[model samples]
Target: MGCLSEESPSRSMKPFVFTWNGALALIVKVSIQPCVTLFSHPKEMASSSSSSSSSSDIGVILNELTCPVCSELYKEPTALPCGHSFCRVCIEKSWENREEDTGYVCLNCREIFAQKPKLKKNVIVANLVENMKLKEGKVWLEVEVQDTEHGDVNVKEAMKSGGSESFCELCNGEAAKRCVPCDILCCEKHLKPHQQKGHKLVDPGVKIEELRCIEHGKPILLYCKDDESLMCVTCTGGEHQDHKIVGVEIAHAELKDVLAAKYPHVSQSMQSVASQLRQVQKEEEKTENSSRDAEDSLEEKGRLVCQFVNESVDLMKSEINKRKMEKLSLLGKQREKLEQQMEDLRQRKSTMDTALQDLEAISFLQDSKDLLKRLETMSDFKSVKRTPLPVLDFSKEENNLDGLIMLNKNFLEKIQKGPVEHPEKVAEGPVEHPEKVELDQNNLRRLYGRSPSLDPNSAHRRIKISRDLRTATRTGTENQYRKHPDRFDDFLQVVSRDCFSSGRHYWEVDVRSSRRWVIGICSNSMGRKGVESGLGGNPESWCLFKGNNEFTAHHNSRATDLSLPGDPKRFGFFLDCEVGELTCFGDSRVLHVFWGNSMDPVKPAIGVYDGSVHFVHLVK
Candidate 1:
């Protein structure tokens, strides 16, 4: 208060006149006339002084005024025709609706100004407004002190300063308003806007609850079969509505129980089946091994059988060849003997013819008469002293015969001269010669002139049997003949019973019950005849049995016979049977038949002995 001061304009007031100094000065004189009355009166001057002082204070205030639009003190205050002093933003907003052609209208007077108005600085009014704001701050503080002392710290203070008016937080208003539920204070204009628009508040809280649809906002309530997932109600009604749906908690409980009950039995069944499969596989392996072994054994046996059969056939063929060689050797010896005999007969016949020719020539000579008279004069030819007449000396003829006989003896000696030795062994004792007996010449001549009956003993000499002939029997019948007196015409006649002939001969034997007979061609004459011998039990005896239906031959322990069903007419010399066939050599005069109940009729028996017959079975 003490610093306040004012200047008086009344004391200095004075009147003044203007005079024209030049043509331009005349306009200045007229311009000063309006200002003359303001300084004429003392009372008017005092009032002017007070107004001047106030104007000066307003200038100071305006210098401190901060505009709400630009936030600075006003330099050139443009007052609208409304007389309000404001910055351009505040004034423009207040008059912005006025038409451009009419220019801005005043907010205070609601006056429309037609011209664009120019603003000038108002220092006094600006200073007043600044001073008031400072004073309000000081007073507001003092009221806050009083409220604190009274224990009312929450209370709002009264306004004592000058500035822009207080505004609501929601709507920016000056009237008092507050929310009791949220415990927030605001202006009256903003209270309803806060409740309805700013805060998300609703009655019953139901609309607020539905706003948050996140999964964590609630527990899962449904199962989605498509994805097999647990989902909330919002997801179920939206994305999973058509899928198979169930309560999540119920599905979980049922699935857990089923898995727990069935696992153990299924595992056991799988293990058992695996074991059985293993057993079957092992058995199959064993069976394969056994089959292989059996095949190997069968192959081995077949090889052995083939080897045995081959060896047996070779041995039999060897035996047959040996027998054939022996027969051929015997035939060679017989032919040599016959040739020698023929040579001896031819020489004897030539000598006899030459002697008969000599006798005929002597009878024809009649010239020796004196020799004949001497023979006639002697009364006894034997007693006459006579010179011997040369009878054709037959003694010389006998000497020629004797020479031939000596040559024959020498040949026989050559044949018998070698050691009397068996082929396989040597005899220990000296070989004995059989006794030599002479035949009567008269009996020999009778025998030589005719076919003589056989004598057993003499025939035995001609038909010499070999010791190798294993079976032979001799009959007792023998007939003997006397040789005739003429030595050249001697023969023997002998009759004998049937006996086994020696050398090699083809023989067929037939047996009927205990009887045996033999039919064969002798090797010497190739004769065909049947000779009955005896039974076949003795080791050194054999026979041939001849019957109407059956024929058999026995030698050693072996017996051969025509089979019961054999053909009789076709079976003769050079016949052979082996296996199931019968064959004959030479003419087809031999036959064989086999009619067994168990045999094949067409196959019967095998026969191949035109030269030789062999039986063989070839096994592969």
Candidate 2:
């Protein structure tokens, strides 16, 4: 850093010039020669600058750029929320040991991050070090720029009609020379102070006549940060009034800082998308390789089957050809089913591309959240099991045929044999199994997706249900929902179809956006007369309560806090009408079990307070 000269060159104030790189700063002590490159090995400088003074400077600079984890110059540095920087490899190694229950978190602060944050390369620090190596003759080449010189162009009185000349800025006298900092023309008299006042000595590049501002008719000295343009001091408080007015150095440093922060985040997002594309290609290649092995195994099995069939009916060759044709038809059907599934994914991706264009910042962020959830969700799958072909035994038929026997009895016995085994079909995405569920919850839910939808007639006046009937919100005004006996006028309550009466039932509510909400089961006899008929306020309703960061289970106006270690966004309710038991689950664990009368029709219900709540139907 060097000082800025003020008043006189002898009494200049030492204003240090600084540049920030990543989360650190590179503060150089002195200039280096043209041959010296900062990017050269640190050990190389140790011998050349063997003195104690130069050795200290080298150590400081190295420490600034090095990562704390590796204790060396950083490679792909990333900053954590705790303000600590580490090499991506070093940090990822630590993450590999984390337990699935706790999620990935900072080792120092124990602060949990949202899954895996993308690893970003710190470009500012890398560029700073790269430029430091490009030196030329005693000057670092990048910072200093040159301009064309227009010197000693004298201008006397105002321009004559026949001749071309210019007049001085101060008095209409002859313009002797131009001042670089103030960008003014002076007639040798007013030119002295503009230079003595530490005005930069730069090539004028243009004549005095054209350099003057068209509006102010003065030389431009400062720049307006708000407007992002250059202006003369006379216009500083005029058209550029109340703007962030600063000199060139201040403007340049401020603008660079903004870019440094913005560029890394944006670039990391783009890099992550490219990385995902490469990962998809790798997985596709692996699937193709696996298919090759399956093909080989199938070919060997088919050969054995053909051999057995050929020996069983050599005399009846027409029947053998028909059996082979049936096997080929089975394979064709499987291929057609797979082709249909592939087409669905292609259409989904094409629609997503068109929807992603021209979105504003708020819309983009919301869409990203939805996309992340979609990525985590398991894909829909329907298992197809094929009955194996009947195997014929010719031993019984031969005895009956007497060297010309019929194969009817033998084929009938084979068709009535033990159960056929079918190949298992794996879904294309992550799989989750509920061990406690009495049935196959995933597939059963899809089949019995019990229209657990919002009942428009049962909505409170202040409650608003989306057109899809899945989402409900507590709005500011009365939403003009029809007045009905089932509608709760006291609290913001909305009931479902009121159809669940017997057997087992399950459903989940998305409470991530709602800080305080009451969701549970409501019996047919639940109160709906007065304003006091909240979920927990009546005896007929059994509810799971959340308010002021507290969670509880309530029945008959009794409340019990659910002492779970963590809060989850989705809350699940599993009700067994036959046993008269209702279990509440959070995140995945059971929170409480409450006894309730289930002889009457029961419905899933919710009461929203702060924000909105959405219902997700589970048929199982």
Candidate 3:
């Protein structure tokens, strides 16, 4: 019985024990299952998580590291030996900033770098950075899940219940519906297309890598003209033959540098030229001012000289008037004295005529007495005695009367001549005639008798008014002062006192060394037939020979004589000779000839009023 009863309880305890062991085993299995599975896929899980986390960290780092120069994510980043990475432009700018220094210092590493840094390109790094940035901006869809009071709705079920939609972040295209099963947002058109066509989509967390030239792999731009090929140094010469290829960063940098370098020089040169132009303008202004001042000074001096000359002319006119008044007074006094002398001569002539008539009557009575004596002796004797008695006293009175008549006649003749020599001298002389009561018979007859009567017709008659005298009288007043003014008189006085009309009546001097010759004729017109007959009528006619040697005979007579020590050729006469000398110094192989009405050898005529003629011989 006991054995049977123990078996029954054991069976029931066994069911309970099995249930407890199963429960513990499930817990153990749940904990240890994870450990066992972790070992089996350890490398795979670690690799997946590390890659995802590294990618996320890398995206954050790249987003933070922007190029300072271009203010963008590094497109073509280059790594320096100092462990710092920068866009090519950022490094180049830092390098240029220290151009005056020995070297550049890295902004990140604080390391002194070479002045010419090795600007190596890291295309792989640049591409990775670009891919990370693209992944951050990838388009995605968002669907909101509605939770009910019962519980949170199933995302997949919600999408299946018309919650699925599509959205494009690039163009802001939003989904209007949701796919419950796919848990995607989609519009009406995209919903069908995404489900049916299974469109390829980029993961929002994935990044795109930056592309570089396939040939060079150095982040340079490929020139389209070069067949769209990338070029390294080798390709640059071969595949890129004549390509318009460029290192993108360097091309842009060079453009900026060129503009900066050239502008300043051009601006400085323009400023320098402008300053020089201003200086020149200032100098010109000063020079013009000086010229104006000089012109004004010259004008002032000219005016002063003109004023002085006008004042001098006025003084000369005043002096001339004073001299004219003095000359008129002297002429008036001389006219008065001449009239008185003429009256005195007329009174003496009348007395002489009366005395001559008395003598004639006495002579007639004596002739009658002789005739009557023969007829009647007694009557004739009485008449003859009466006439003799008158004659006896008639001789004394007749002699006195005859002397007075002769004296009166001579005084009258002197009065007829122009004005008497000196009125003062005549007034001082005795006016009364000499009283001779008993004149000698011979003296009385000599005084009364006339020497002879002048013949009315004479062979060599005196010229009443010759042509030369008439011409001199006609123009005398107008030309008198001009021909011999006080100035000319002074000049003549000096010349005449110092020089003589070289007695060489007609002489010519050949001053060849002085290129001149002087010929002259001296004349004195004091004789009966003077120099006026030989050398024209005036003394100045001799001056006609002053120029050249050509002579002409006109009116009365003409002659010419030329003498030379040597012969001459091609002779000509010059008519204008105002100044300077005439020379005959030329080749001596010629002759000058002349002929006139008179062939008489020129004789030297000498007189007090002689003039000279001169001839000038000019040398060739």
Which candidate has the top score in lDDT? 2
lDDT of 1 by residue, 1-620 (tens): 11122341111222211122210100100011110111113444344433322111211222224332222344344555555555665455434422334445443233556765775556564443333332222221111111222232211222212112343222233635333222223454334433432222223212322433356343243456568876544465466656655544445665677777777878888889888889888888988988899689759865874775566557655755766676667666766666665666565556545444655545524423544454344443222233333333345334434543553454356458853233124211111321121222222222211111122232222122123221122223322323422111111111122222211112222111112223221112111122211123222222333444455544333456533344332222211111211122111222222111112111111111011111111111
Q: Against the hidden reference, what TM-scores do the models get?
A: 0.21, 0.31, 0.24
Q: Count clashing residue pairs per candidate.
A: 50, 3, 30
Tens digits of lDDT, candidate 3, 1-620: 01112122321011111111111110000111110001112344345432211111211232234432233456588877865566776566445433343366554435675556677877655643443332234322222222222143332233345322244211113554433212234444444433432222333222211223355333332232336443332244454544554433334565578888988998999999999999989989988998898689759866874775466456555555655666656555655555555555455455445444656666756654653443333221111111111112345435544654554454455458643332223222111322321222233234322111111111011111122211001111222232211111211110111112211111122222221122222222211234443332332222212224332211123333333444332222211011111111123211221111121122111111112211222221
> What overall lDDT goes with each candidate model?
0.34, 0.58, 0.33
Candidate 3 wrong stretches, greater than 4 Å = 1-63, 68-71, 75-78, 87-296, 334-620
Task: Report residue 198 deviation for candidate 2 (angstroms).
Answer: 99
Residue 533 displacement (Å), model 2: 1.7
User: Pairs clashing in candidate 2?
Assistant: 155-174, 401-405, 490-531
Error of 3 at 529 (Å): 63
Q: Give the worst 10-residue stretch by lDDT in candidate 2.
A: 141-150
Best by TM-score: 2
